[model samples]
Target chain A: MAETYPKETSNTVNRYKHQDPSIPVPVVLPMIGQIGHYPSDQQPHCYLHGYVSSRLMNLAASPPGIPLCVAATKLDGFVLTLTPNTHNYNYRSAILHGHGTVVDDESEKLWAMQLVTNSVVPARYEHTRVPPDNAEMASTRILKFRIESASGKVREGGPEDERKDRRREDVLAEVWTGVIPMYERLEEPVGGPYNRVGEVPGHVRRFVDGENARRWTYAVEAARKAAPIKRVKREDEG
Target chain B: MAETYPKETSNTVNRYKHQDPSIPVPVVLPMIGQIGHYPSDQQPHCYLHGYVSSRLMNLAASPPGIPLCVAATKLDGFVLTLTPNTHNYNYRSAILHGHGTVVDDESEKLWAMQLVTNSVVPARYEHTRVPPDNAEMASTRILKFRIESASGKVREGGPEDERKDRRREDVLAEVWTGVIPMYERLEEPVGGPYNRVGEVPGHVRRFVDGENARRWTYAVEAARKAAPIKRVKREDEG
Candidate 1:
């Protein structure tokens, strides 16, 4: 889901570009039944979802399914202002509202499992063992979520201090204020004990390098107030 | 809050240790009024909070106050299994239930602002401009949340596949299964345009290097099933 905020608003303020999804965002899966009861006057139902094994799924499965929510966030930069009052962060976050249910269909469960595996490292499913055996399939449980609503929020750009602070010559002269760009960097992969492979596989290496560069470039450019360069020309473009 | 999951249950499983708060988790402040209304049948009082300007706070202030929730999560590693069916992730997450209100007291607001700034990078508050001026204070809005409830959930360690898969000699021989350690690395800090400082400050430099080393060591040791080396002996030790 994409959201737009007024230019003046503190949240949903995009700097480099509006509603860019290529930037990797952190994902969150809220826990179900973890938070105790909210007052009756407050919102009653909160949802959370996570993967489960068949053993655990059978134990928790009841008439009505479990509640679940999935969320992800991408931190852009740390906005450092001259004063603490104006400090802020640029970020993009999304939340998915859903309820968790067991994936009963064998093929669908396998597909979901593969999807999740590949999500950690692109195309990793093809590199590993193929279809799981019957016992493995029977023991594994996939929590298929039926999503109800989803929302995305974003905040970007340099610090937004008050006009008076910005005008203060003395403070501005002494105190340096700007964003310290921050992004996750994937380091050189360490091989496992039984990793028979001579070197890190091409796919794994490429994914690590590619993702690190993409995020680093985006954050540095955003801090410098540079817009992302479009690779393809659109028909509507003048 | 700490949750104990039944050995047979799945969602709240804690693998390595229980409720270790030193790990840096991603902090999230839910935005108010951004998420559309939840159906009363679901959860009635769903509260969220986001940072706002002092100007907006005055306009939005009302009795009974706004509800809010703060969340943080730390991703430990990606659990890679021989088969796709058993893939999982190691993580730690915390949530705080609270009500948001404006911090009207000047000193308290400054203190809270400093606390938050330093939280991003330890000792960072002292490095920047000191107490905010009146106009900066007037414009900045510190959301003093009255926390009512809090809870933490965690998952860690290697993949836990079906017993049959673990026992299968042929599967074990051919298929490699282990965790791909993952942790957030702070990249080289970028200086601001007007940053007159000759180099990255010692404290900031040390923090970046220290955090990277700490996380890297933890992930590597966990991947190898090695216990962390204790820097100091506990009081209980002879």
Candidate 2:
């Protein structure tokens, strides 16, 4: 889970606000996050950057912090089966159960900021204006999440049909069962209004080309693989 | 909110258990969901299909259902700025607060089933084997979400830098700030081992080509647009 989004830093974080003891509900926030092990830390944890609601900000300021579930899901392909009920997705999902606290240490905060910035585009922090001013540092708030437990699941390969459906020649003849490869693709860079640089930087170009190629290969390869014999029991299964 | 994800159906749902009043944390599950209004109903609601943990299933079975939050996020592009703190992503996120109950009404359940199947690939339910048998229907479970409220946010356009950074000639010249367009791309479909059909059907081909074009256009257009004058106040703002 710690290395799930080393490059792609988008994930949804779930925070529960227990306002009433009798009833509890979760608040979901789409956020940018990166997992890294600080030089001085014993293990890796997650650093989350987002403007949480004021209520959640207060929750993070308290002792022991707020309990959170950080999740990242990547869709590889859509598996088309003989029946709609059996259709599934080839995907990878990672979830971490943790407690989040607001990072106050200047050094750790700055390092985490660099880690997150680079996570977006490799070495992007150094490419931009260096060492944020006091005002910038003061304004930024990062949540340091200490993960207690984590789990990940990966499902890949072609579509799977039930034995009964496989035996029916009529259904097989009519229905088109297969996998549609899908992935996040980075298009050519579009320079900003203030950009004075003659050409897209080397770092930016590399990231765009490299990610597109890697993602395409992964999705197509997954589509070509054999389906798992014992598929995870979905809600549609009796 | 009801019209959100009318075509692409992927959302993460957060469910919390109040087993212990002293401690509460959210459980996040990546699931397939779609929003639709049945002809018999006055308003639209979300229908979710997934194999939830047994505990969550039990919770949903109880009266009033289980309180939940369903969220969908789409990243349009990466916005690069002169400073690391100002860097952001052009994206859209939607969240719905609701209670999820298992759909028991047979007719409604069947309708919701078709709704969710087509959400994956347009008109997919009818293309495959028709009318699930009693066993298939008995095994499948669809969660009907009664929407209490919902909200959404969209961010777009080029990089935004602070006044000081914009004034710095050296910083402006050095940093190649811009928007790198990003979007999910669907590649050519690959048939499964047991697929008897020779060519990718019209429905599957249309979905792949149509979606790729639509997503690509949206991302590039978003990158060329003007940034919001007063961006959402992020944690990095003092």
Clashing pairs in 2: none
The lDDT values for all models are: 0.51, 0.79
Model 2 clashing-pair count: 0
Candidate 2: regions farther than 4 A off: A1-22, A229-238, B1-21, B229-238
Residue A91 alpha-carbon offset, candidate 2, angstroms: 0.7
Q: Candidate 2, A61: how far from true, in Å?
A: 2.1
Say which candidate scores most in lDDT.
Answer: 2
Given candidate 2, what's the lDDT at residue B168?
93
Tens-digit lDDT string for candidate 2 (A1-238): 1110001111222222222434556667788899999989988889998775555667778877877778888998999999989999989877776678888899999999999999989989999998999998998899999876566678889998899999999999999999999999999889888889889999999999999999999999999887643333211000
Clashes of 1: 19
Q: Can you give the TM-score per candidate against the true fold?
A: 0.63, 0.88
DockQ of each: 0.17, 0.43
User: lDDT score of model 1?
Assistant: 0.51
Classified by CAPRI criteria, candidate 2 counts as acceptable
